[model samples]
Target: MMPLVHSLSADDEIFSVSVSHDGTRVAASYNDAIMIWDTHTGCRTLGPLKGHEYWVWSVAFSPDGRSLASGSSDNTIRIWDTETGTELLEPLNQHTDEVTLVLYSYAGTFLISGSDDHTVNIWDPYTGNLIGPPIDTGDRVSSVAISPDSTKIAIASFNNTLRIYDFATVSPILHDFTIHVCDAATGISIGNPFRGHTNVVTSVAFSPDCRYIASGSDDMMIILWDAVTGQICAEPLAGHSSGISAVVFTSEGSLLVSGSRDHSIKVWDVGAVIRRVELANGSNSIVTQRIDLEITSVMSLKDVVSRLTDWGCTDMSAELDWTSVGDYPISQGGFGDIYRCKLTDGHEVAVKTLRVYVDPDEQTRKSLKHAAREIYTWSKLKHPNVQPLLGLVVFREQVGMLATWEPNGNLPSYIERNRETDRCLLGAQIAEGLAYLHDLGVVHGDLKGVNVLVSKDEIAQLADFGNAVLREYTIQFSKTSTKHNISPRWTAPELFRGSKYSMEADVYALGMV
Candidate 1:
């Protein structure tokens, strides 16, 4: 489609563009700078943001429209307050190499960035904290997109793989799709990745409804697949002059926009032939976009229980108005501060606010994923001995996990206050919980006293799965606990050796009771 008016100079080679959520401002990356344009004011350049030392590769506006994030070849991502033009963060210095792409999740609660270092990092745009640990792709990532609802993230990499991760589990649900299809009814299968992409897959996108995912490869073809069934549709989108560089579904979902080395953009008529009734106009409405132009662009966790090492934040408590809970000082640690608060529904919860001190880019990402996993795991374990998960509040700059507020405090404190016999019973309860987890194929990777919570009923409940793994637990029992209650003394010699111990190992450790 031709522009009504040239928003960018033809010779400037605009690499990426993102319109503000309000549609009032537009930011485009070109070479080493990011240029902002007043969309309603005839696309005039408002000013140039010369913050990056190298080519600015990607740009995004925060959900509130208060800030901007730019990724550059300088191997950093910078956060800027849009209103005052002040840098909120010094170049985000986690990526070891060039920052190739960056984007904001639909809610504007998180930023996802991909780097030439073959890693994808998610960050808190506001505090510049790492959301979770860096996701190692083992190949340079070219593009990244979070699903509209922000529940699933799709990453394309030089390894010729498309990785799909669950926003909750923070674990990969799908990987390396090569032309494959399973029958929806009979469950039949066909095709292979090697046959479909003669070269490499370069771009991918989810349909607005997220029912389908479309991928374009260096083979000059666009393949649409059933997102749920993984079956190829009726036809491959053909017409690109050369290898495709990028592909995206129009906002309206009426067409596909693709760019290629053929030096032109091509608009494909995907839904054009479908019939539609226009109720507003009381007639049949037909819509289509002509794609023939091509251009290019590119794109955890756990917890510990050490109250002394933890630091609290006023900002998070202020956001939730938990000050009424009294003068409880929240402290920071591997996770953020732990706060006790009441939800709007009158439910009491223990909320953990994740923070940043230095450059938290990497740590922030890991924390988010860790929080997500904890929520997922806790939600599934319906045992009374397991701490209940209430919900979570996640934003671009911060993330907090909410859980059942046990006023009785942690197991270590409870054990400290009670008799040795009571401690022995508590240890048995923990063992029972561990035995249950093993029955369900879950392994609490870091078993410690702080991870256990004591309820008002005097029941010992297992908490904290930040370092837990779903696979078999094989670490040597020597892994000490952060809280000096049971980990170091109760841990077994075999665990410290990192041998292939079984559920019996946890039982043996618990026998110290």
Candidate 2:
């Protein structure tokens, strides 16, 4: 029978309304009962599908358009098959308080409910069994959403702060760079590693003005790591088409810049990227938004060199002097290939290049980008004890980053060459550098006597961040073993079990040094 619009709207006040994905049906909650209508005909199609003991407050249609979910003041939630208007099951009773909102994931694989009970629970709509642990909202949860990727959830609560959780379960994550928190007082571990990156972390840098950390990896993706929780702050940034070699924030900290083996430098608006990440992380039902603020510019290596030159980065054209080039590389462990060269200004600089056998003309630019990934991080650091970088340059035959020369060489060699002259001051300087890096939430990755170089002034500086973990374990790449790439003599025993690198591991290396 056709229901008179005037009678339906005037006599019955509706609390909520949801339209089917196909636009063929509408479900509206009215006075403890729900009415389903043929949207075009204004005729009641189904319901007063009533079983609720109290007022109905929320309603939503499943993604497939075949089911409807409802929450009510009765402290119960129900699912109704849209086709036959049949209740799917008895009301789910895990929530102790009123159910405020009900929603479905994109694939209709699960249902989510928010309640006055201060918790959010995922349910198997078909079986009514709860999935995983009930997420405590800390207060009455008003709204909740799962990210587009279904990897995270955001909850808005009465506490006035929004909380985000990773719905994805934690795994061993040995191939990924994780930030592990440990207690300063007792030297014991605190919690799980901030695990998100998909590949070995070759480089990490702190945003100058923000609470974010950036990491580059062989996976060719750049992840913005949250400094506070060691969680990923945004989606993996993807324009480079090759592994990221280096990443850094601009002087103002408003923009982030990354260089890739693709021989391109891309500038990003950090705030915009973060906001986009938040929205995409909010709900799987939401479409990912692409904004201009996220990407400002993409530049070729030639352009980057010219721009820096215009900004007074200093000319190194004359440094091509073959005689000034070192007879052999300083060493070859952490993405090795280093040569000592003199700049046109007479300043000695070390050029670190990757040894790729592919012909530049025949090689795809993508392949070259992977080769450049090892040395790009040097340009962003400026600590008195951090490796001082001059600039990055792209060459047809050789692409690389440049750093100020440390004539005193590595600590181990410097000590061996100069005899046991106490070396207390150098050790203290190395400790100071480590403190600086840890304060920024960065792990040196490859911290050894060979990676720590000393200046003529006797101050020790840290280098070779890419080697902090084993980037290329060609033979045992996937074999889970008790031994990782770290040297047994200096590494912590716990890591000997083929685990990932953490800040604590770096500290352990420092002790051995």
Candidate 3:
């Protein structure tokens, strides 16, 4: 489809375009500079953010949208302050050849780059320092992507092969990433990007039920994809006359929304063939200069967590106000901070805000994944001895896991206060929780008294799945590395040698506790 906005010199073509993680800003790479636009107004917000002397090869926005990173043919990488459009001082100049790609880790902690020099370099953008020696790809690198779990890096090279490197194994695999439906057992992609749009496909989203995929295009239509068959499932949604640029689904997938350059946001029911509602900026409907053309853009949901997991409307996270977080942290650990928080329902909870980091070792990554999965599953756990994860609250850039509020404090603190009472009751409560977890094939690798809470009823409830997640993810560490977060005094000696977490390991911790 022809662009609504055009430039005089078509030769100086815009090679790439990107939307910010929050979907507020749009960016495009031109011959010598990068341009930023307001996704709503379609007006230039910042740029030409000019610092590169030659063609800008790639541009990416940080996850938090605080900064912009760009690589160019000038053989250097430059970062820009998004608000002021000023180039960060002291450009990164490690590559001998032109840099082609620059991407921030999923959490915006580190910036990595690929270059024509046939090497990938990791950078701590906060300090502009290289994290380690570069990994030589032996061919000109075309693109680089970090895995969703951020434990591996994949590189597409000009030599017509893909390379994958794992942080844990320090070994590389040569071929992956072209959007194939991989078999769960054999690891082969049977499905690729299903293409059908005639003009520029502006926006794509998946339904909450995962049965349908939606695409909005400049062709002025929306198509629902049959995910199972990789074909168009329903009739095309035709309403907006101008090309569409953005599309998103509500939490339930009952409704889909699309935005277009014509300046309108059209809402459509999942199975319907027509628009249900049309909203425009400044007015309910926008009227373009073309008279017949009008449009709407997407809007941020009230809940920031919705920004990430809208498709999973039943997700563990719910919107929480920043004010709910207490002024002081109850405790802090290597990977997160805990706070006493008040939920919107007017109840207290223990909140752990995960520590966001970059270039983490395999152990740290495993811990994060394990903890996250447990947090996701904790909502389904029902037992008096096991603390129920109330839900999740993510707002203002802070993510927290909220759980049962134990006013009586932790078990260790309770034991210290009530030195005279026998601790057998609390031990039994912990044992019950362990029994429940064991039945589910879960190992509560760390079972110190510190990880147990005393409820208001003076009953003990197991708390802190921080180590529980580590066991689930199974951290991979070198044989010589002994330093860890596991409580050595409470831990079984066999665990120090990397013994698989089993019922016996937990029983040992329980016996000691």
TM-score of each: 0.39, 0.36, 0.43
lDDT of 3: 0.62
lDDT of 3 by residue, 461-498 (tens): 88776556322343332232222487788888888898
Which model, 2 or 3, shows the larger lDDT?
A: 3
Off by over 4 Å in 3: 1-12, 167-180, 183-187, 191-227, 233-513
Candidate 1, 1-513: lDDT as tens digits:
111112233224455555566545666666776666554233444446777898877777887778889999999999877776678887898999999888888888888899999999988876789988999988988767576687677776877666667632111212343544433222235333323555567666666666666777778888776666566553677766577656666544434555555634444534321111121223322112111111111101113211101312112232344444545535444434576677655667777654421123544333333333343445555444667555555422344666778877887777677755366657666875786566455666556677789987677888765545554121111112122122566576786777644456556655654
| Candidate 3, poorest ten consecutive residues by summed lDDT | 287-296
Assess each prediction's global lDDT (C-alpha) against the native: 0.58, 0.62, 0.62
Predicted structure with the largest lDDT when compared to the true one: 3
Q: 223, model 2: CA deviation in Å?
A: 34
Better of 1 and 3 by lDDT: 3
Model 2: what TM-score?
Answer: 0.36
**Residue-level error in angstroms, candidate 1, position 233:** 18
Cα error, residue 396 of model 3, in Å, equals 25
Instruction: Provide the lDDT at 34 for model 2.
Output: 77
lDDT of 1 at 131: 88
State candidate 1's TM-score.
0.39
The candidate with the higher TM-score, 1 or 2, is 1
The regions of model 1 sitting more than 4 angstroms off are 1-5, 149-151, 167-513
